[model samples]
Target: MADSTVKNTYVKQQITDAMLNLLRTNELKAISISHLVAAAEVSRISFYRNYTEKEDVLREYINTLILGWHVEYENSDKKSEEEMLGSLFAHFSKHGDFYLLLSQRNLFHLLKEVLKTLYGPKPEYPNFGAYVAAYFSYGLFGWIEEWFARGMQESAEDITILLKNRK
Candidate 1:
């Protein structure tokens, strides 16, 4: 089972990478599974085993990339908010290309949902409410999108520091 899981992850990454490479010069609609199979150098059977279509590969890749960090946040030992946010930034920096393409494709609806996971732990303060979570959900995502647009020039550590100091 573990071997299957590993192989599945490896093949899926290959397919997703191929799709991104294709997206460099072609729109999503213009790229077919055959193109992906050829580009990835994987068999059509391998592609079908991992994904139903080119978009599925990209969508799954983005969803996994976003959700994995939130899961880590939820499961981690107690840590400072800066450290947690820095971890998230580190993940984003590691997968900068994926996020960059997702941004260009305007495929960020799932990002808000992923960020909404942070709302699960509500506080008792007057300023802490669903409204505040909603505000952060939207505002933070917009800020992040803009940050990516500015070329992500800051290191993850620097980003964490800036965000921590931001009013």
Candidate 2:
């Protein structure tokens, strides 16, 4: 029983890793069950045993990423607002291709849901503060996209400085 459980876990991880790799090279829409199974070196039956569809795998992947981020931040000492923003930006920057793929329309909605789960409900800010936070998140995503587009021209520190100084 233990061995079977271990095998199941390994298979799931393999599928997840395969999907991530495909996302790195292709748009999310281009990923299919056949491609995932082939990449994972598993049969279609094995893939279905773990996930019903590609979106299921992608949902699980996003959830895992968000949960991992939550744990990392939860374990750390208090961080300033700037530090928090920088850390979040750094996380997305590290996964540049993944973020780029996820920044698309449908996937970005899912990303926002994951962010809400990780960070809780958006804070209540008065007037312009709310607009600022919204723009901050949008701008942060834009900056990361620009980095990936330009082959990461500036360092994360430079981007963080730019974000901080944005009026």
Model 2 TM-score (2 dp): 0.68
Model 2 misplaced stretches (Cα beyond 4 Å) = 24-26, 100-110, 120-151
In angstroms, give how far residue 108 of model 2 lies from its true place. Answer: 5.1
Question: What is the overall TM-score of model 1 with all chains considered together?
Answer: 0.67
Q: What's the true lDDT of residue 108 in model 2? A: 58
lDDT per residue for candidate 1 within 104-140, as digits (tens), equals 7666554555666644325653655667777766767
Measured against the true structure, the TM-scores of the candidates, in listed sequence, are 0.67, 0.68
lDDT per residue as tens, model 2, 1-167: 99989998889989988987887778777887888889998889988887777878878887887678767876888487667767766777677667666664246556665554444335666767666666656655556556666666676677778878986
**Ten contiguous residues minimizing lDDT sum, candidate 2:** 113-122
- The residue pairs that clash in candidate 2, if any, are none
Please identify model 1 stretches exceeding 4 Å from their true place: 1-11, 37-53, 67-78, 108-110, 117-128
Q: What's model 1's overall lDDT?
A: 0.75
